[model samples]
Structures are given as C-alpha cells and as structure tokens.
Target: GEEVAQTPKHLVRGEGQKAKLYCAPIKGHSYVFWYQQVLKNEFKFLISFQNENVFDETGMPKERFSAKCLPNSPCSLEIQATKLEDSAVYFCASSHELPNQPQHFGDGTRLSIL
Candidate 1:
C-alpha cells in the first residue's frame, strides 16, 4: 500500500492570512491530489498532479487555491486568502497512474480561522 504524508497536523490562521499545507507523495507514485473538507459530509477535490505537472484541477478555486507537485520536493497546497469558511481539514492523497489503483490519503491537517 502506498503512503501519503502531510505536515503540520493543525493550522491556525487569522482572517485574510495565507494558509499552506505540505504533502509528500508515496514513493514510486506519480499522482498527487488535494482535497478540502469544509463540512462533515463535504469533500471537495481541489487538484491533482501527475509527477510535477498538473493533471486535473476540476474543483480548485481559480484565484485563491493553488497547488504544486514538484520534482524532488514535497507538494504544496496554498490558500492565498483565509476566511472563516476556509476553515476545514485538508487531505492529501497519492496513487500510481494506473487504472483502478486506489489513492492513499494522509491524516488530514485541520485548519482553523481566527
């Protein structure tokens, strides 16, 4: 099984401050993904990268949310402007670029707005 690693178990930010989360994709895996859980039942896929290139970014917000999966570096998801509604758990996932290969998720980083 693949392992996805996320840093900073919790994050607290003031309103309008920037928030950043880091992720290390599983070794030998080239695909990385970021998801935001703003509610108990809501999980929104933010972005996905194949190796160092963005693969799909269906649900990412154009202005405030950006991510990078760079070679020889940990992938990063950044929120340019934090708001009360942006407080949530952010999950990082990784998988091989094969059909039916399940993505492995790390323990989410809980973000709080102050």
Candidate 2:
C-alpha cells in the first residue's frame, strides 16, 4: 500500500552539530513537501518538489538547511550547525499535485537541540 514513511521518530543533537532526517513518500506520488512544526503548533513550509525538481524552496532557511528528492530513494532533509531554535518536528508529505490534491504527512522527525 501507499504510505509516507519517516525514520528515527526522535533525534537529539548538540548545538553547532548536524541533524539529518529521512522520508519516503507514497509510491506514484509526484509532489513532495517538507514542513517544520515548532512546539507542535503551526506548520512552516520548508520546501516543495515536483518529481525530482524543486518547485519552491523560498520558505527554507538559506544558511543551514538543505533538502533533496533522489530517484529510488526516500527524500531527505539535512540541517547543518543546529541551534536551539531549530528544534522542531520535521514532516514529509506527498501529493499528486499542489492545487487540489491533499498532502499525506508522516509522523514526523522530532528534533531536539541541546
């Protein structure tokens, strides 16, 4: 069956270190997105991709965050030089398209910076 998968439900990192999260979108889905939820509140859009091409990434932090959708592999988001404020739930979602299709979210990768 089709489902979004995320591993390492929880992660702890020291300040100035790096954190990497993974996501596997449902099969046949063409659009993938990444979001960050701080304190389990509002979701902040980080990036979106159509197939292997990035559609939009304006919401992503320029300095330390990077993401990619690779063929035959689950999508990944990497954070460099983690900070206290970077602690949050990182969710991966996938949809057929952005206009009408609803995105399915994974349980999320809970990141804690200490």
Best by TM-score: 2
- TM-scores of all candidate predictions against the true structure: 0.94, 0.96
lDDT value for candidate 2?
Answer: 0.92
For model 2, name the residue pairs that clash: none
Model 2 lDDT-worst window of ten: 1-10
lDDT of 2 by residue, 1-114 (tens): 288999779999999999999998998889999999996679999999998899999999999999999999888999999999999999999997669889999899999999
Query: Local distance difference test, per candidate?
Result: 0.90, 0.92
lDDT of predicted model 1: 0.90
Which ranges of candidate 2 are over 4 A from the true structure?
none
Where does candidate 1 clash, by residue pair? Answer: none
